[model samples]
Target: MSVLLNLREAHPALHTHPTPVLPPWPRVVVLPANRSPYGLDLPLDGTATVAVRPYVTAHEQRERRRELALATLGLDTPGPYWIHGLEVA
Candidate 1:
């Protein structure tokens, strides 16, 4: 069986969340384990899994700022505007 199948059988709680909609090939940033402020306790083999929480929070902040800027310019920001440029996936 595949890893997903194993995970599904071993941990049901992991499947509680809805499937996240992501691009076919998403960008990946690999941070060196020594440089990472997290995952220090884990036995990392030179790389660390970066947290998405910071990136998500930053994206939200950027969106709010864009809205404010648009509002100041007497224009309304669209409800679901596609984010362009580096989105730090």
Candidate 2:
């Protein structure tokens, strides 16, 4: 087990189940659209996982994520959106 995982097991008061890190491959579908969203078929094998909650205390660490997320064209934030998903084999 990783040291972080061990730490979580040791301190229930300070830690919790982390997020599942999805395998970088086996794509997870993200529906990004305003006019009738479409489904994306991910290639996931369904075994990979990521942390459930944050393991870090700094917000700066996540800044890169936000920036990368906004890199796509024609994407604007702070908008009305609805999302629902289903998974199948």
Q: Report residue 4 deviation for candidate 2 (angstroms).
A: 87
lDDT of 2: 0.55
Q: Candidate 1, 32: how far from true, in Å?
A: 35
Tens digit of per-residue lDDT, candidate 2, span 1-89? 69989888888877556779986787688986655245445555656865444646356446535644664554545544322232211
Give the range of the ten consecutive residues with the poorest summed lDDT in model 2. Answer: 80-89
- Candidate 1's residue-wise lDDT over 21-76, tens digit each? 97688669887656546746658664556656788999998887887677679787
Q: After superposition, how far is residue 1 of candidate 1 from its true place, in Å?
A: 99
- Model 1: worst 10 consecutive residues (lDDT sum): 80-89
* Best prediction by TM-score: 1
Runs off by more than 4 Å, candidate 1: 1-52, 78-89
lDDT of candidate model 1 versus the reference: 0.70
